[model samples]
Target: MNLIDKYITEVGKHLPRRNRADIEAEIRSTLEDMLEERKQSPSDDAAVIELLKEYGAPRKVAESYVGPRYLIGPRMYPLFEMVIRIVAAVLFGVMLLVFGLGLIGANLSGPEFLKTLGNSALSLLNGLIVAFGNIVLVFAILERVLPAKDFEKELEDWDPKELASEPEPDSEAIGGPGEQIVGTFFLILVLIVLNVYPEWLGVGFFDEGKWVIIAPLLSEAFFSYMPWINILIVLQIGFGIYLLRQGAWNMASRIANILLELASIALMVVMLLGPSLVDMTPEKLAGTPLADVADFFSKGANLLPWLVLGVVIIISTIEAAQGVYRLFKSSPRSPYPVIK
Candidate 1:
């Protein structure tokens, strides 16, 4: 095709399907009319180049015809990006865990190991592509179907009173919105992995020239608490998104954080005090190298639950203290500036 035809074709590619032909025809006619007024020959390549340059790049021309086109608009773009990142991170973690298990079971050597790594890389790439594609598709549809006014209304619904920060003699920022976002993202991932794909938590062993899959390390007791755990995770994720949107923590969010922490502490207590939380049964360990360490596993298993419980208690206490401190710091009589 000639310069004019090629330029029109490029622009047409970006136009909506229904109006592409009409828009392309109009653009072509306009360009031809402009060239005629300039007394430039249509067959002259230099003239066409100069005219096309003045008309702008094909994308710019297409955008002009389309008028503010976006698969996902600016208002929703940040949330879209955040969701994509969270999904990608979760998929990466799942793939990494699977690859590690495969390596353990394959007993691969030299070239075999390299091949496994190559396969893993390809798998991760494909998985990410599918994940990101789905997320983008969902957001794109929402962009078109969800009314802009509704989103505006949602943004306007926030209460300024929620952001009242407490005063302290030597107050410091507890955690930024970024940190909360990252934390909640990983928390969501953990919840999904633990509940939806518990099998991925298992170890793999090569036995008798064949690969064997072990049961998950976590016991059935862990699964029993998943419903409640999932609720806590969802609440935490909502709170994190709120923080991200608001760009700062408020009195309400701090209280919610403490309550979530308390819920977590309560859940951890139930899990730790419940029946053996390890599924290291002899049958499960049989024919694996771990069988040799059965006694060690037993000993560690007995102490592991208590150790986890203690850690959770310590963290929860600290978080609760911080929340209380922040509440007191944001007192009306305090001289420190409130977040609102």
Candidate 2:
């Protein structure tokens, strides 16, 4: 066969059947026309052969038409595309909730509950908005790397096995170290707002200083160390910042959970032991550093607050454990890789 014929046949193998013959004919005609222009004489087989060689083999030419070009191929990963979509929807929904609450808090006026409800709703809406924005940012980046035609093909052939069987992806799969940092930063933020916020943890009779349940005379001393609970708060905030800066949310979260868990267990122990410990009395303080304050308060009432604190600690621990378990044990499809 002639060089031109061979070239056409090779390229045609890669094209769809419907377009194969048409594309082959077009290429053949174009090459012949070029040869004719170069025809200084009636028969110039050598020139035609040289032209076909310079043009390239048919298969190489056909590659240009076979698929949409991408800096990153969609086939490079099938599951990641779906993961991005799901995360995007969830993030959008959360951002809407936060924004709605913020608007309500700004405009509404009412009793404590009504005011609080408005404020909280506004916070939730604002959070949702932030979440949505992050999701969009991630997806926008992925779009540039993906092949256009593969989008539909990916959807049509969605398969779980396809994802798991994908070659073990490196850290770059998520968006490199920088994107992982950003993602971890956002993850910690969501955790702090949802799990570690003080207003949510600071509740109950002791928290509000319910005088009827205890007594006003002993209230301040009874709960003076309550602010020490803020130690846990400080640690958690630090953890959030660490996760943001270092991209270690999974580890930081686990440590934070353990801290709260230990604190909770300590609280329960204190409650069991507080009543049995020595009483607070003026005479007991007479020679002590607190002597000046002895005339002010009784020991039992002072002890009462410790018991209350112990209760808070226990409750906080259980909550922290549950949260930690859920965070660490999410499904395989989770965007965040479970390190363990």
Candidate 3:
């Protein structure tokens, strides 16, 4: 009867576009079965009405088919969690490095000393909140933008064999939106901060109830590399977007990533082995509370750049290795022609 068709239409209107067709078909089939079981003709709209009533109203039926929504849906959740852990670890590691350096050649016991510690903790808390907000914002956008078809599979069609390949996804679906979004967000932020407010990367402490700043650690030696650094970072940003659009890594993109990592390693090596990148000149600290620690700042703080570069070099080498391995692993046989 037209009543059954109308009822299914109404239900379909309420369901997600991806699931609407299948659900509407299922509901229609069930209603038809009920009509047959009750020996009711399609012409008898009253009997069909009774069947739909028992099935529940369209809105209620739609609600039953769906559950709660998520800001970062189930499929991408593992990736989101992983990025959070990495970000937290990096932030804490940086805080520890800065705190240790600031403590160099200074009296560790005083009211101002405690204030310094409190300020560092508050700064760390603020950093975590900002990072979390950025992550959530990107993930929420991804959750709404990604297609629903990719989120889940039909439960009835699941196979035990899926466990055999649980660690790997389809070659085309590798390195999904989560990785791209998080990486690009942070990298862009780094570029902005370095270019716009590089002074934020300094040490500060209270000196006789007035705030004092040590010379910012970045030196002319480091800024000189900005052109090359800009090229690499901008290329990296573009490469990440390409991978997001491609939905997976291909041989060309894999090669591109490898080259980029190699370039990063080379830059870190040059910065590490070349002229000093950190300069905490004593002149700037002449009248500050931290004046006595000038030797510690100029010498000890200078070592931090080397430590950072070394760590970056190691990470880039590993990333380059992995990119090489995957590139060959997924490469296809070269095409050849033979003549009879």
**Candidate ranking (TM-score, best to worst):** 1, 3, 2
Q: Candidate 2: where is the Cα deviation over 4 Å?
A: 1-134, 141-223, 239-260, 267-340
In order, how many clashes per candidate?
Answer: 5, 13, 0
TM-score of each: 0.51, 0.29, 0.51
**Better candidate by lDDT, 1 or 2:** 1
| Candidates' RMSD to native | 7.9, 16.8, 12.1
Off by over 4 Å in 3: 1-173, 205-212, 330-340
Candidate number that wins on TM-score, 2 or 3? 3
Predicted candidate 3, C-alpha RMSD: 12.1
* Residue range 33-69, candidate 3, lDDT tens digits: 8899999977798897888889999998988898666
Assess each prediction's global lDDT (C-alpha) against the native. Answer: 0.78, 0.55, 0.78
Model 1 stretches astray by more than 4 angstroms: 1-64, 92-124, 142-295, 331-340
lDDT of 2 by residue, 5-74 (tens): 7678888888889888888888888887887787633245678668878777666788777765544354
Clashing pairs in 1: 165-330, 166-329, 166-330, 167-329, 167-330
